[model samples]
Target: MNQTSTECVRVDINVFPTAPPPPPPVVGPIPEKLLKIMRKYKYNWRLDQLSKPKHLEKKFIAEVVEPLKIVKVKLPKLDPEKEYYADQQSIPLIRWLVINKKLYGKQNGKKYRKTINRYINKGWGSIYNFYKKRERDRRLRQRKREAKKEKRMPDFERFTKLAIPKRLFKPQSPTKKSPAKIFSNFDRLDVLATPKPFVEEPVKRLGVNPAALTYEPTETVIRLAQIPARLKNLPKPLEPGKVQKSALRYKVTPRIETLAVPKQRNEKAKVDEDYDPWTIPPNVLKYKATPRILELAKPTERS
Candidate 1:
């Protein structure tokens, strides 16, 4: 037999174009002032790696530390009397700082976890308590406003009101002790005239009107009224033979036959009773889990 030989074949494919060269790193040496601030305020970690330049490849001096410097410079100028207000003002800045630190940690392969946690635990000061106080104050102001609105004066009365002065009354007057001689209402005054006899007026109503007594006809009554009172000719009675023929013509037809077989005596009644339309057939159905359905179908896992 001829000697068998194997040779490797080479193939080259330029399906994907070569990617462009990466931009040069914009990194610079960490400033002494930035390092000092970081040490003082505890802004970031990996200070030990400052001497080892490789670990400080992605220094977050501009993104993270610069804002802290600005805040430090402005802190003294802000009024200390409104300390809470100043703190509230710094909320957005602190939140942004924390978020940037987290992003930086992620960029450095999560090596600076303490930096993120420190900012979250230390830098974010009493934010939840501050919001709670604000909400409480808002509710109190709302209640005060509602009460003030309630206490507001109403519109002036339409009728003329006279303010009777106490000076108009005479002290220890004989007329004040005596009963009034004049009666304002004539109906209540006693007179020498005899009582008049009751007389019925023709214009005055004695009973309810006939039209008012009667109710308006309903739709059913109006529709029934349109029908003739009497028929010109009465309908003939149905014959027994014709009625029988009509019943036979309209009788329901027999059910169509089905090819389905009846259950055998050997088969269990549960087979037909438990049949679900939604269930997949056993022949083609698949269970893509460990221990199939037996373990999963249980209410609690086997001990």
Candidate 2:
């Protein structure tokens, strides 16, 4: 008897991905709500990547980064029958473990390392050169644009003079006034009397001003005929927004000197009659507390 056997062939297509496709970043403009936060962090960058710390791995953590889910660890079965700690056995931990995260994986680390090394080697200088190159390119582009604009423009003055309307350029005869009569009809302005200026009288809190007593009415000061003319001798009515020249002088009235007071002492010592401290008093008045009177009452101890 002949037996039939079937041979099976397994074709495993090894689809070793070149690199796992990067996650879609939640990139956006610095949101209006985040403007104050950006200013506080001094991260005033306009790029979409600068504000996305999770995907971009830029400087500090940003709001775009989502917090990791807490992991719960179950407690060991110390007492299986007890139900008191049943609900509380599994503890949820909210902590940041500094282990190798997805961000530090082999594929993403190369770029981060490259940038870090670049920054370490030359931080400010590289940024400066990049901006300088951009500015130079911008200036070159502007020059080219201006040159193109100039080439496109026609010579303005080369064209024929604009057709000016007759009403615009036509000259008209000016009205000439008749010659004035030279005879002295009105008094000459030069011959008019010059009115005296009203001088301001100094204000006194108590005594009346001496200059006000001899005051004369003038055109500059307002004259209130109803009241005594002497009362109007005060300073001229100031123009609405104008301040008096004296007001700007800031003269602090010298504070009146205070009256002198009798000398007083804060000690119980009485004022004794004058006596020379150097002169020795007679035996009756000699001080008893001298070195001889200060002898030690106890026997002196020897070291």
Candidate 3:
């Protein structure tokens, strides 16, 4: 009603209360028991003066910060064949989100999606590139090992030279003269001229009749009957006279008393006129009768 007269008066009405800045947003003191628990569990938390905070900042730090700090993270190994990635560069970012579960929430659920995005934007962009390079290097080493294994395989040429053919193992034939050539000189003449068959003829001195004896004719009798042409032409012996014996006995008879007289001894006596001349046969003189000389003689003269 007093301003009804249109008089301008500046009255400051504070929409947000400036009552001593709301007593500087009262900070609850950390309990000694909770601090001890945090010290024991938080492995990565800095206890240095530069990182320690005098008062907690609600905007920057969570109201009930988890006591545990993750010192290490373990990601599940990727099955490169199955996972769908935008490119090889996205591999490590995915690995980081999976492993650092505390940084991003448990199970990589929606609550931690924003944290993942923030890490990707920040200097963590090169993580995937580094992982891809390592994967490529490992694959190269594996390929090199496979190449070395192939090189070490046995060479076919080496084995082929060592292998021998079955035909080469056959035994060698003996070197000897043929049977036909050894008996070439044998003939029928050699068979016929061998030796006369020996025949045992019985003597009948007791005036026994020859017909009365049991007589067996031998091969010698048959062979002798077939006389050679050369021997058949030879002359027979002359017959002796019985009457000449009486005439000769009377003519040559000297008185026994006169013949008994001492005769002069001669060292070389000539001959008696009545003695017959000794004639040597031609075959007997030419033939070699000794057994040793016959054995060493030529084959034609052997028998």
- Regions more than 4 Å wrong, model 2: 1-128, 155-303
What is the per-residue lDDT of model 3 for residues 50-88, given as tens digits with 9 covering 90 to 100? 467789877866588678886887889777754534344
Q: Write down the TM-score for model 1.
A: 0.15
Error of 2 at 173 (Å): 17
lDDT of each: 0.61, 0.57, 0.64
- Kindly indicate the candidate among 1 and 2 with the higher TM-score: 1
TM-scores of the models, in the order given: 0.15, 0.14, 0.12
Best by the lDDT measure? 3
lDDT by residue for model 1 (226-302), tens: 85756635556655456555666874544422334453443554567765556676765674556867677778533
Residue 67 alpha-carbon offset, candidate 3, angstroms: 64
Residue-level lDDT tens digits of model 2 in 188-236: 6555666668999986566777899899878646554467876768765
Candidate 3 lDDT: 0.64
TM-score of 3: 0.12
Task: Give the 10-residue window scoring lowest on summed lDDT in candidate 1.
Answer: 155-164
Lowest lDDT sum, 10 consecutive residues, model 2, at: 91-100
